[model samples]
Target: MAKNLLPMDALIAGYLHEAVQDAGITYRKLAAVTGMSINRIGIILRQESPPATLGEIGMIGSAVGLTASELVERAENVARTRQDYDLVANDSINEFPEGNDADYDHA
Candidate 1:
């Protein structure tokens, strides 16, 4: 399932790493708090296979002082941002700049 997803592997993994960095916890400490192996934690931050379960995700949120819902929102937001970017990129219409539309143009 992940293979078919947007932003691809390292994207999500990289975001996870960024989240940990932003969370301000050492990997070992996070692993200890999440009750998972340092290796498993690495997999999550690294975005490897055997992806984390929802429970693990929740644990990560707790470890980072984020709620599970907030964490999911963070992840979901990545997809949303990508979609927004794509939409803007594909748009062919030019948005008139402020004064450019000052003339009564919309008859």
Candidate 2:
């Protein structure tokens, strides 16, 4: 399996994407206004390589007429929702591996 990464990042990205959708605006418009790129938008949406930076989020908030605090709060709420989803999806999840540390070098 691939290494596990925190799911909150993806949740935050999804929140931003949903906001754009709610505004009936395309990422291109946001891209032009915020000097962001469509390709990067996908990354932001997926919380992949192009995950949102604080500056990026601020720029997007400005374009969407959201206060900085409001935007951040929304992002946080979305992340929580995503966490809930992840918990449901991985009901039998383990947060860390179990093993005898002496067996091998651990990073």
Candidate 3:
């Protein structure tokens, strides 16, 4: 059986939302700058749908003052953190018993 994975589209949308908020810009302004329709921007930012292409991501990132690479890198970091948490949560249960002095590396 395959393990369930979080959707990358949602992660990217979440990062984009945070970036837009941090930039202190409105959707109308972003639409105007990126030459994108407000509804399309809404779809992407709200995670109603993923952007159709890398060019769309680029346009959105540029409008929000982030490079495409930077935007993706940050989203990737978020994904990694979530994956790590899921793994630890799933695997660590009952691994440590009461009064057990097992040496473990905390790196």
Candidate 4:
């Protein structure tokens, strides 16, 4: 079975969607500006896929006139206001994989 997405994923997507709207950027315009595909942008904005990668977040943020750090900070602020923020934040940490040296091996 496909794993369910973390609440953080939806939260981030919602934040991005609002930011894009506030910036007056359509998905097509954002795609053109960021050199990303509309389908990918739609997937990210609509929460149809997993949370975006750091690189993708940066691209999207740039298109919306925000830095990646700023975008993430804003998202965290939004998360903090939710009643289940603690549960969602802790769950995200618990779900992350712990890695050792071998996990980063290139050879």
Candidate 5:
């Protein structure tokens, strides 16, 4: 259930860490504020495990001065950036043959 929030782990961890820092809070403070276990917060911030539940994300975000939606968007942006790099690196953009475009009529 929590895993459904996002597919990527590292990006979300990065966002969490950055937000915590931006909010000028330590992991211990964040855990205290969010009512989450300090070890859980540490693990996620360290990229050992991602925060899976929306509830978890919301608590973390509230402590770090962001919203669950904002964090999700940040994670999505990171995923999109990674995808773009993967496509470019693999040359998938050129996978379609050069002559293929001519086979389809332009409206």
Candidate 6:
């Protein structure tokens, strides 16, 4: 079986789509409920454009009966789990070469 990997943004978008459907809220109605413009709500529903701020996320989560913290944690979890091997190479490491501190200093 081929490995299937999805981006965090796509995962979050899918989650929002499911949450809205489960809550029985249409996108237009959600716009009214959240006091965000239809265009903005469309962007959110599309999931291509994530909520710009924590406040925006709070509004969405509240409408879907989710806590803001819960939504944030879910997004973080998706991001954490979706990393590829390439990301491992970029992770921070503590190893440093030993050298004279005075020689490295330039002023």
Q: Write the per-residue lDDT of candidate 4 for residues 1-107, one digit (tens) a residue.
A: 54445676676667778889899988889999989999989988888755677788889988887777887787778778987565353545554356665766689
Question: In candidate 5, how many Å is residue 107 off?
Answer: 29
- Candidate 4 collision pairs: none
The candidate maximizing TM-score is: 4
Top-scoring candidate (lDDT)? 4
lDDT at residue 74 of model 6 (Cα atoms): 82
Candidate 5 lDDT by residue in tens digits, 2-100: 332224555666787888887889877787888888888887777764444678778888886789889878877767777543313245644667778
lDDT per residue (tens digit) for residues 1-107 in model 3: 52232366566677788889999999999999999999988888877744435677789888888877887787778768875433222545547665564555365
| Residue 53 in candidate 4, Cα distance off native in Å | 1.0
TM-score versus the correct structure, for each prediction: 0.60, 0.58, 0.65, 0.71, 0.64, 0.60
Q: Residue 48 lDDT in model 6?
A: 51
lDDT of 3 at 28: 96
lDDT of each: 0.67, 0.66, 0.73, 0.77, 0.71, 0.65
Tell me model 6's lDDT, rounded to 2 decimals: 0.65
Question: Model 1, 1-107: lDDT tens per residue?
Answer: 54322243344455567778997899899988888889988877777776666687678767877665676666667767675443232333356666778674877
In candidate 4, where is summed lDDT lowest over 10 consecutive residues? 87-96
Off by over 4 Å in 1: 1-14, 84-107
Worst 10 residues of 6 by lDDT: 85-94
Runs off by more than 4 Å, candidate 2: 1-5, 77-107
Error of 1 at 60 (Å): 1.3
- Better candidate by lDDT, 1 or 2: 1
Instruction: Tell me model 2's lDDT, rounded to 2 decimals.
Output: 0.66
* Candidate 6: tens digits of C-alpha lDDT, residues 1-107: 52222344455555667788898998788888899888876676676544335576678778899866776578777667765523222334233346655765687
Order the numbered candidates by TM-score, best leading.
Answer: 4, 3, 5, 6, 1, 2
